[model samples]
Target: MTLFTDIGALVASAIGGMQADGILPGGLDLGPVTVEPPRDAGHGDMATNAAMVLAKPAGKKPRDIAEALAPRLAADPRVASAEVAGPGFINLRLETSVWQEVPRAVIAAGTGYGRSTMGGGRKVNVEYVSANPTGPLHVGHTRGAVFGDALASLLDFAGWDVTREYYINDGGAQVDVLARSVYLRYLEAHGQEVEFADGTYPGEYLIAVGEALKAEVGDAYMGKPEAEWLEAVRSFATDAMMELIREDLKLLGVRMDHFFSEKSLYGTGRIESAIDTLKSKDLIYRGTLEPPKGKTPEDWEPREQTLFRSTAHGDDVDRPIMKSDGAWTYFAPDIAYHWDKVSRGYDALIDVFGADHGGYVKRMKAAVSALSDGRVPLDIKLCQLVKLYKDGEPFKMSKRAGTFVTLRDVVDEVGPDVTRFVMLTRKNDAPLDFDFGKVLEQSKENPVFYVQYAHARVHSVLRKARDAGLDVSDTALAGADVAQLDHEAELAVAKKLAEWPRLVEIAAKGHEPHRVAFFLYDLASDFHALWNRGNDQPELRFLQEDQPATSAAKIALARAVSVVISAGLGILGVAPVEEMR
Candidate 1:
């Protein structure tokens, strides 16, 4: 279905035929051989490094192998010419019929044009946005949520059975602080004056939670001690906060398949079982870690503790899993969580964390490796910060969320489509500047607007063709004599469409969804270029007066571009607009 992949198979077959004729040695590795578009358009349509990769193995000169390979490739009906470039690379220019078939293939496949079976139905669990269930999600968590959600969708499109998961950090002491904070609000609901100390949360958002709690209990805990009501209040507060987090994620179109609670790992011997699995492999030991390099804390002391021999599996040093006082460290629960994921029979695991969690990467990787017996691969992606700007000044914090800008703030100001598209304009590891004024501007500098505008223009062309008594449906366009679309400008857009399948496989294999956004922008640029060129050359216009055949051919190419843009936007969780407002 992919033009580049088909051509690559043809090149491989030609080389295989060369081996059969005894022109070259047999059994040479062809894994390094690749067929892709030439970087310079003038060189040729496609280029391959077959000769360069096989020359050393066959004990022959690269140019000599290229010379023999060119003739065999040129013999194919689809290839127009095959020329040996510098060194050993062979550039191929396919027949016009080959490029013309691209639009027809796109029309047949519709939005499913780029979906691939590369994953072979393997299971992958992507865990992201595991922020503490203490408050509403902030901008930092928003980036992780968007990246993880898109990655899961991309993997699914590549034929992977992906599970989107979120780990709730509800077992930590922070939930206790939330309980105390809610207690203050609960007291305030009964006409009692209270002052929030430095340690308690003072956000006005929690006032509603307090009011709700008062409605439920009816002053049952008004005269109770902290010990009597702490557990119940903590449970209520975490549930409320998670509901808030879910609503915030709904605003940005992020949905998780599973929500695992850290508290569930406790009192269930899950942590003990996970550590036992590691102990059976001799990865668990009792040792004292050397003092860290930076500065020592006032309570820092070296003590023999239950440790994980993480260095055995590629970590920088051994990590402690249990404290000297018989309490599990923070790392224990994380190992247990990953062990739970490994037990579920996932072939791959991905963790999307904020940039500040860089230290957890190696240790977590080591734990998965030891637990999975080197079977399941783990990839951790760290999303950098998103800096907000408005009118050339830094955006202020949200008064509702107390300390940071909530995800709802961004999605509410600029609709969900804009928020999701703009978030992925940059790679996850790179810092992104979200300018309120610039993203809303209807210009080429704003990628979301430019891409949306290109899709809208395609619809305008369809409307104009319909009014002119031309059948512009996809079926009608697919059967048109597309050979009329031989202009370089028109063919350029088809060539870009042909890259969709290859691009999807590449992005899915790398576990990077930002590449989808980048590809869409380039495709939009090519489409816009073709549109602008039509303005100056009346013959290049999509609809011609009294020329239904020519107009249908041109309209087919325009519809193909829109189809690809829609598919790419779906991978990024963005909705393509038919009309830009």
Candidate 2:
């Protein structure tokens, strides 16, 4: 049902036919030939580089290939004409009937209109929003959470068996600090004042956890030393922080399928087992790394340690798995975590990390590669910072989060829908400026409002058609005379609808969901442009009060636009409002 893919298949068949007819050599690779929308709309509905890409390999001039391929493509009933453009590019102008079928198809399919089976049910593991359980999510984690969740949804729409996951860094020294901090709060909860010195969390959020601890165990080990209550309070505090994190995620509508804990690898021998697997591949060795560049050689000393040969798998340097003191470094558990994911039989793995973790990307990839032996591909996406603004100035931090704005603060300011939509307006690696005042503004400058307004307009048209005693149901709209939608304004909206399936596949393959947001904005712009034209031209209006047949056809087009916008918003994990208040 993907028109672009169907046309691509037809083009491939024509190439094979030419080869069978002795016009071109058999078994030539046709993978590079692409049938896509032309860069210039004046070119045609679709353009192909088949002739230009195949000419050199097929031992013929590009113009000759184009001249021969043009008639072959035109033979299809859908192609009204196929013309050779400059430099052997062939542009195909499809029949108007072909474009008209798009809305009917959309009405028939509903929200499933743009869904594609491009992934073929491949299992994909998406690990995102894996901030340490030390505190509630911040603005940095907010961006990663939105990006990773949207990306997973986009892949799911493209037919992948997607697994959404979160990795909890509950085993690190940070948790120890958290335990001590909670202990201080626990002491304070027992009617004793405690000081939060350096290396301890000072956020007021821990106050409730501390009180809960006091309730759970009253006067038990209240005067004990660090060794007596450290482990118990650490476990208790990590659980509390994770609960807070989950609530923060829920506020933004992010739900993870699984939460893997780094602590799980500690006593389970998983870390040792993963390191042993790499050792078998000769990827592990005892080596002394040279001092980091730009550091004084006299101030730095190299010591032997267990290291992973990460350079063999594209890392710039070998990474240490164990420290000089024979303790496992932070990288050891990470390797085990990825190894566990690899052993789960996922076809692909993706990690969404904050941009500050940029240095860890290559080493993590190397570990996964070594463990999986190149059987699975790992993609690491780093989300850059988000700058929050209000009234053209940056918003202040939350006192509860100590130094940064909490995810809850952002969500509470603007509801979840606005927060999610605004978060995805920019690419993951690009810094995003989220203006609280600007996002809520019901202007075209705000894409969330613009897209939502277009959807609401479609519903308004459908309502008008229904009030005029015309059937605007999907079943009736599917049978409407969309062929009568021949006006340039009507066809322009249909053409935009036609790009949905193609856009889904493109976004899924590139692992970028921001493309869906961009496509929705363009589609919304086209719909609004058409709607504005109706003010001057009565024929372009969707609601023809006196003519039921004409109104049904026009309503079918409007309903199709909503169907696409809803589907795109669904992929972005944003709700499509039926009406704007």
Would you estimate the TM-scores of all the predictions?
A: 0.97, 0.98
Q: Please report how far candidate 1 places residue 304 from its true position, in Å.
A: 1.3
Native-vs-model 1 lDDT?
A: 0.92
Cα deviation of 161 in candidate 1 (Å)? 0.7
**lDDT tens readout by residue for model 2, 209-308:** 9999999999896789999999999999999999999999998999999999999999889999999999999999989898888889898987888889
Candidate 2: 10-residue stretch with minimal lDDT = 394-403
lDDT of each: 0.92, 0.92
Model 1 Cα lDDT, one tens digit per residue, 1-581: 69999999999999999999999999999999999888998999999999999999999999999999999999999999999999989999999889988998998899999999999999999999989998888888888999999999999999999999999999899999999999999999988999989588888889999999999998899989999999999999999999999999888999999999999999999999999999999999989888787747665788788999999999999999988789999999999999999999999999999999999999999999999999999999999999999977998856477877888888888888888888898899999999899999999999999888989999999988888888989989889899999998888899999999999999999988999998898899999998899899988999988889999899999999999899988988989888876
Where is model 1 more than 4 Å wrong at Cα?
294-301
Error of 2 at 347 (Å): 0.5
Candidate 1's TM-score: 0.97
